[model samples]
Target: MEQATLQTPLGMATILGDRNGIRAIRVTDHSEGEDSIPPALAEACGQLREYFNGERTVFDLPLAPEGTDFQQTVWQALLGIPYGKTISYMDLAKQLGDPAAIRAVAAANGKNPLWIVIPCHRVIGSDGSLTGYAGGIHRKKWLLNHESANPQQSLF
Candidate 1:
């Protein structure tokens, strides 16, 4: 249940983690404290900085998002989305083997707590238009545009 807040391109982000892994990473407009940064928090911040700088993709840090089984499944499916690609909620529902569960899938996505890491931002409307994001559609648009404009360079 450790937390740290830092500024990000889209806004300030509040990162929460425990010894097990990161529980959530939320975007905010301000920081909450000035205490010394914990080691895990610093490491997470470093990884986030690398991500924003376009130097990292596929984060290796641990994560432990709190959610229902269905939500967890939806979040895992989101992880499969490639960095610069986008998918529709309907497509995601189909991938879950329940085409009619598009609304449920969208609900799960809306509840995603890890933000950019779990990449709920990559989910769009059936018309290929950006839709709901807890962090705001503007941030979602910026994230999509950022990934598109800065294609990752392979480290291998």
Candidate 2:
């Protein structure tokens, strides 16, 4: 599979995929960008950069995230969530025609392979507090704040 690790405001986002589509995009700390970027990953890499630069709000890429059918459904539903918006797990569950599936929905959300692209960070506790994220709660906060329409101004 084609691969590339690029630096971003969150961290080193390691993207893995090939001509079929993007398989995964995960963020980690203090890693170097790949010395050689694969041709297949050029567009995905470029799009991610644009997202961080606030030049792009929506992603258009051939994504091939591997997960169960239910998980796939959850991820697709996640895409419906607009940029700079938040959705409670309850709302997400209700949208899927299963209000009782909140835990199942949240579980599937946690397993989302595509990070920022999937916008799982937009899902929060029903009370509006940031909830658990595979990338850590702190990273979730940073991501939400980054995409905020009314961005919090620095006290400095």
lDDT values of the candidates?
0.88, 0.93
lDDT tens digits by residue: candidate 2, 17-83: 9999999998898777554778999999999999999998999999999999999999999999999
The numbered model that scores best in lDDT is 2
Residue pairs with clashing backbones, model 2: none
TM-score of each candidate? 0.91, 0.96
lDDT tens readout by residue for model 1, 1-156: 888877788878888997788999989766555446677778788889898998987777788999999999999999999988999999999999999999999999999999888989999999998989999987998888778956445489
Instruction: Show how many residue pairs clash in every candidate, following the order shown.
Output: 0, 0
11 in model 1: Cα distance from truth in Å? Answer: 1.2
Candidate 1 contains a number of clashing pairs equal to 0
RMSD of 2: 1.0
Candidate 1's TM-score reads 0.91
Q: For candidate 2, what is the total of clashing residue pairs?
A: 0
Clashing residue pairs, backbone N/CA/C < 3 A, model 1: none
lDDT for model 2 comes to 0.93
- Cα error, residue 88 of model 2, in Å, equals 0.3
